[model samples]
Target: MKNKTVAFIMAGRRQRRRRWILVTSFLALLACALCCAMLLLGSTIYPIQDVVRALSGENIKGVSFALNTIRLPRMLAGLFAGFAFGLAGNTFQTMLRNPLANPNVIGITSGSSAAAVFCIIILHTSNAVVSIASVVAGLATVTIIYLLSRAKPFSVGRLILIGIGMQAMLNAVISYLLLVGAEQDIPTAFRWLSGSLNGSQMHELPALVISVLIGTPIIVMLGKHLSVLELGEQSAASLGVNTDLTRMVLILSSVCMIAIATATTGPIAFVAFLSGPIAKRLVGVGFSNAIPAGLVGVNLVMAADLVGQFAFEVRFPVGIITGILGAPYLIFLLIRMNRKGNL
Candidate 1:
């Protein structure tokens, strides 16, 4: 009997490890494919070799304009933002053990959108100023949510409800700002409001990349702690997890990534909220799937952007496409979760 038990345990452990390895490899390959697809997509097609050459420091004129000046930065922004959203969303959902704890739900994206809209419309700040304003607003929004949510016993539901209210109010302010602004600024503000990467320039890409580079490792390194937290706060505390500090650090890192991404690309919608769970489901993993989540986030943005580009005469922002895709799924989740008393 003892020998049988030991063998069963060993088999389970080996299976878990095998699943992790398989998921990780799949994510890595998917990321590579996304990069390649993004490089090759657009009004004008460029060869994969030319794309590589341009990236490798050889300038091929028209190819340089096509790859470097245009597609590369946009692709990088989508990649990093999607990854951050996925990682951050998974962090919150795992820590809180709730599917709806994504940044989009928590109002971070709306907060950034509110500020970006204000800058573009009322402040007449375009180009760089809009990004700075968006980041500032996002950080502010995070602080507000933390305070509103830090009462007793930490309720994720209260946090989400308050966040939704705040989102509505901030959106109202954006509308007011637009209402009072000059007619000429309206189109630019509209673009920002729609959460498109259409106006993204190469200059804005570096700051975003740097922010992601710093945050990604932090989230990855905390994977074990996050997994432990999923066992419940009591168990995590018993396991020496310093639950509060770890959670705070993860949230801050996630916020920074999302804020920077929002500033760069506007609120690209549902990438953060949906990618983590979808990836987890695909990998048939438990809650320790933030890495796969991030990869799915990347794949989602690239795929959605491709769809937006080709499906219509007018290019749609990936955010709009994501909203269309994610809304029904979210409703389905809510309905099922409510029926199961999980909400």
Candidate 2:
């Protein structure tokens, strides 16, 4: 009986692993398709051959200029930034074991936005300065929220509450900056604040790309520890996990990726908030959802961008479309959580 039970358990495990692999693979392929759509389905639709030729450095008149100059950067911006937000968002949700603990709800994005706005309006700094300031400010905001949440015995609920408070405060500051900003700067600041992918140049991509590349491996390498951490701090420690070290590393890596993505594209709405749960639901349970989450983020941003570009009478920002999608889900999640007494 014991042997039979062991065999059954092993078979179940194998089944789950297979399912995870298949689902994750599907998500990856979907993301790739969305990326292709982003590149191919703009105002003047370019054929696949033209896109391929243009990508290969062939100067095919209008095709080359349009693809190389405009669409490629936009696609890349959505791909990398979406991946960053998704990965970081999943890390936070998994580590904190709360759906509400994402960077979006926790003021991390708000912190970066406030800093970027200040740079744009008051300081009138360059994009580089704004990016740097936003990163520093994001890191600082997380640190502050973490410190404040560490009162006596730590509480996830307390941390979330504090984060929400911080978000409110930061938003007020952003409004004040807008009010005092020069008329010319207001449009620029508003555009950035709206979390747009417009005018995304290739030059502005390296920092975000590098951050995602570096941060992703670290997060995935620590995936097992992250899963263990989700079992509560004391339980994780008892299982020989260094909860503090793991938590800190995860937070830092996540914050860095998210901050850089925010700097690159202005905190594309709720990609961080919505990616993890969606990935978790799609990929199911037996493995880490990080990769799938990132892929889902990529698909969401790219698909949303495509919709914004062509779905309406006028082009809308990617963020606006995502917000429209995410807000209703947020409301539903809150109601469900409240009903379950988890809120």
Candidate 3:
């Protein structure tokens, strides 16, 4: 009787999990369709038929160059970068089991901003140079935060606190640079800081896409290790899970995604922080949907970019839209965390 009940419970859990995945997968598809709609339904309003033609090879007069060159790259960049950030962010939060353990909450994005700010203002560099600087800075920030938080063991809470401090310091430097920069240079610095996927070049797209392709699978493949790690380090070790090696590999792979995304587009915003929680609610809590989180990130970036581009006269970066949306979610998370005594 006891064995039968246990088997019944397991079967039920599996069925429920499958349902959860199906629901989230459907939502992801919806978001992707909406992205295409936004791409086509811009100020010009190119019909989907023409858009598809231009996308394939059937050049459609004036729409071809505009859609293919301008909007397509921008749309794709936002999509991929958002996906990368979301996947990475969720991995960290889930691995650490802390709501605040996201790429944005840490100084990672700030590092990119700081480097890009310096390049724009003092270096007077071109776009390529700025992107390079952002990647370097992102790596440095990640390294610092990782080192500071890791002693004999890992502590997610301490890591977040330190990351917040580091972010504040980086922000102060960026602000100071902007303040003293020549009038013309300030705008460049300002734009990089704000995070935009606008004006994405066709050249960068291949490289960015390739990086995502490479790193995404590594994240997905590591699911087994993640599951083990969730069982606690000692338990994982006893169970033949190499905790240190897995953590290192996961961190490296995630950083690659982040650096590539940040380089291609500016570090957008809260997709990383928000996607994991949203996807988790849809999927089972025990399963890690790093890919799903990435898709959510992609949806977030593309959607925000579209809204920012046409929703207002100013044509803001996708980052601003995300900031507006994410801030409220973050506050709610904070309140909830407090209520749960995790704060």
Candidate 4:
């Protein structure tokens, strides 16, 4: 009986692992397709041959300029930024064991947004300065949230509440800045606030790309520990996980990735908030869903961008489309959580 049970458990594990691999693979392929669509389906559609030739440094007139100058950077911005948001959001949700604990809900992105807006309006700084300020502010915001939540007995609920409060405060500051700013600067600030890919350029992608590349490995390497951490502090410690160090590392890596992505693309809405749950639902429960989550984010951003670009008579920002999609899901989630008494 014991041997039979062990064999059954092993078989189940194998099946789950296979399922995870298949699901993650499918998501990766979908993301790739969306990226291709981003590059190919713009105002003036370019054939795959033209895109390929243009990518390979061939100057094919209009195709070269459009593919290299515009579409490539736009696709890359959505790709890396989406990955960063998805991965970081999943890390937060998993570590905190709450759907509401993602950076979007917790004020991290708001912190970045407020700093970026301040730089745009009041300081009139360059994009580099704005990016730096936003990244610093995001780190500082998370640190503040963590410190405030670390009372006599730490509580995830307390942390989330504090984060929400911080988001509200930061948002109010943003509103005040906008209200008092010169009218000329308001449009610029609003464009950034709306989270666009309109002016994406190759020059602005390095920091974000680097952050995602480095942070993703760190997060994925710590995936097992993250899963264990989800079991609570005492349980994780008992299981030989250094919960504090692990949690701190995870938070830092995730914040850096998401912050840099925000600096790059201006908080492309709900990619962070929705990626984890979608990946989790798709990939099921056997293996770490970090990669799948990132892929899902890429698909969401790219697909939404495509939709925003062509779906309506007017061109909409990618963030607007994501907001429209995410808001409904957020409402449904809240209602469900409330019903389950988990809200």
> What TM-score against the true fold does each predicted structure earn?
0.94, 0.97, 0.94, 0.98
**In model 3, where do residues sit more than 4 Å from their true spots?**
none
1 against 4, candidate with superior lDDT? 4
| RMSD of candidates 1 onward, in order | 1.8, 1.1, 1.8, 1.0
- Model 2 / residue 1 / CA error / Å: 1.1
Model 3 scores a TM of: 0.94
Candidate 1 lDDT tens digits, 178-230: 88989999888777776676756788888888888998899889989988988
What ranges in model 1 sit over 4 Å off? none
Model 4 CA lDDT for position 282:
89
What's the lDDT for residue 3 in model 3?
100
Candidate 3 total steric clashes: 0
In model 2, what are the clashing residue pairs, if there are any?
none
Task: Name the lDDT of candidate 1.
Answer: 0.83
Worst 10 residues of 4 by lDDT: 148-157
If both were scored by TM-score, which would come out higher, candidate 2 or candidate 3? 2
Q: What local distance difference test score does each model get?
A: 0.83, 0.92, 0.82, 0.93
- Residue-level lDDT of model 2, residues 142-169, one tens digit each, is 9999899877556889999999999999
lDDT of 2 at 132: 94
